[model samples]
Target: MTASRISNTTGWLSFAGVVAFVVGVFNVMDGLVALFRNDYYQVTSQDILVFNFTAWGWIWLILGLAQIAIGAGLLAEQSWARTAGVAMAVLVAIGQLAFLRAFPVWSVLVIAMCVLLVYALTAHPRTRAYPEA
Candidate 1:
């Protein structure tokens, strides 16, 4: 790969890492809140609509770990990391759909970030430079 391509790829990867880290931090906070108070996300009065606190806690924790792993991989420019990062980002996007009430704004932000990250990761500049290496 040419130096320019590598440079651009690194740029995108680094940006992805930073963004992921931010999202991860938010998720961690959400998890902690869930752990402390099950009623933290009481946006609905319907008994069936309410999510269990422990379940949400686990979800947030798992997603937080995934984000951190993807962020680290992107920062390091690992080939497998890049692939897994894409998968993780997509999973995060899909997961957010059901978690709209818990983190409405953050869910929207994460979806937008996932869209941007996918684009940046697959862009010609980064693709040409990195070549999956």
Candidate 2:
């Protein structure tokens, strides 16, 4: 690849990495809150889509750590990170749906971010070739 093309790819990957890192941190905080203060959420345990607050807490905590590791791997330009990042983004978006009742706005925001993160990781800028004069 040309230098400019490589640069562009790197930039997009970097954006993905940073977003993954931020989202991971957010998940960690959410998990901690659920674990410690179940009442902090807007809904009761029964209202949750799948599991109770404590279970979700553990899920989010583990997912968050994995995301953080994926983010770092992406920044390092590891090939596995690209695939893992896409999977994680999708997983996080789906998880947020389960979490929507607890924090509607935050869950939606995270979903949006995950969408953008997926795009950044997957989409590549088109290149054009020109004939030499």
Candidate 3:
């Protein structure tokens, strides 16, 4: 890869790391709100897709923490982080969809970020060059 392309790829990866971290932080805040102030959300527990706010609160809180860890790994350029980030981003996007009714705008925004994160993680060129015959 050309030097400029390599640098651009690195930059995108770094941006993805930052995005993951920010998303995680948002999720943590959302979880806390759900846990402490259930009334903050528009929908009631019965209205949510699955479990009540309390259950979702714990779920988000745990997932957020995992995302934060993955973000750190990505920033450090760990190979596992790229794979984990893709998986986590997908999960987060799905979870956001499940959460759409509670907070429509926020869910959509997070889903968009997750999509960007996935693209950033996967769009880079392969580092290993195959032997040409």
Candidate 4:
């Protein structure tokens, strides 16, 4: 299909793709800050709930890269993007939770976006917007 034949679900899928892509970029930035610019964060590494900032940085970096790839797939309407988006959203949400104490507002915002992405990706069945090649 064509754009005219696309259903409302197409909008949601596109939204999901964009949001995931943006979030992935943010995650990469967060990771970099955590790693190289530790002073940027409000809390010290010891104060966080999960691993140290360095470890968290690596985790976020990897997660972010994966998210970016999945988001691109979503945008391209790849058949596997939906499932990957759902899984990544869950992981990102959990990461936000662990990160809440350090940056409350930003973490919450990221979590909310992740939720939206999850909802958009899973709320309805696949639409004609994307077809496997």
* RMSD of each candidate relative to the true structure: 5.8, 3.8, 5.1, 5.8
Candidate 3 wrongly placed segments (more than 4 Å): 1-9, 125-133
Return the candidate ranking by lDDT, descending. Answer: 2, 4, 3, 1
Candidate 3 TM-score versus the reference: 0.86
Question: What's the CA error at residue 88 for candidate 4, in Å?
Answer: 0.4
lDDT agreement of model 1 with the native = 0.72
List candidate 4 segments past 4 Å from native.
1-9, 125-133
**lDDT (10s digit) by residue, model 1, range 1-133:** 6555434355766787777777777777777887777676655323323466677778888888777877787777767767776787788778777677665887798789878877666655424655665
Question: For model 2, what is the C-alpha lDDT against the true structure?
Answer: 0.90
Ranking by TM-score: 2, 3, 4, 1
Per-residue lDDT of candidate 2, residues 27-88 (tens digit): 99889999999989879999989999999999989989999999898888888999999999
Q: Which of the predicted structures, 1 or 2, would earn the higher lDDT when compared with the native?
A: 2
Q: Give one digit per residue, the lDDT tens place, for model 4 in 30-125.
A: 898888988888888889998999998898899998999989988888979999999999999998999998889989999999999999998775
Worst 10 residues of 2 by lDDT: 1-10
Task: Say which prediction, candidate 3 or candidate 4, comes out ahead on lDDT.
Answer: 4
lDDT of 3: 0.89
Q: Runs in model 2 with CA error above 4 Å?
A: 1-9, 126-128, 131-133
Candidate that would win on TM-score: 2
Each model's number of backbone clashes?
Answer: 0, 0, 0, 0
Best by lDDT: 2
Model 3: residue 130 alpha-carbon error in angstroms = 15
Residue 3, candidate 3: Cα error in Å is: 20
Q: Write the per-residue lDDT of candidate 3 for residues 8-117, one digit (tens) a residue.
A: 33777898899999889988988898899999997888888888899888988998999999899888888899999999999999999998889999889989999999
Which residue pairs show backbone clashes in model 1?
none
What lDDT score goes with residue 130 in model 3? 69
Cα lDDT computed for each candidate against the true fold: 0.72, 0.90, 0.89, 0.89
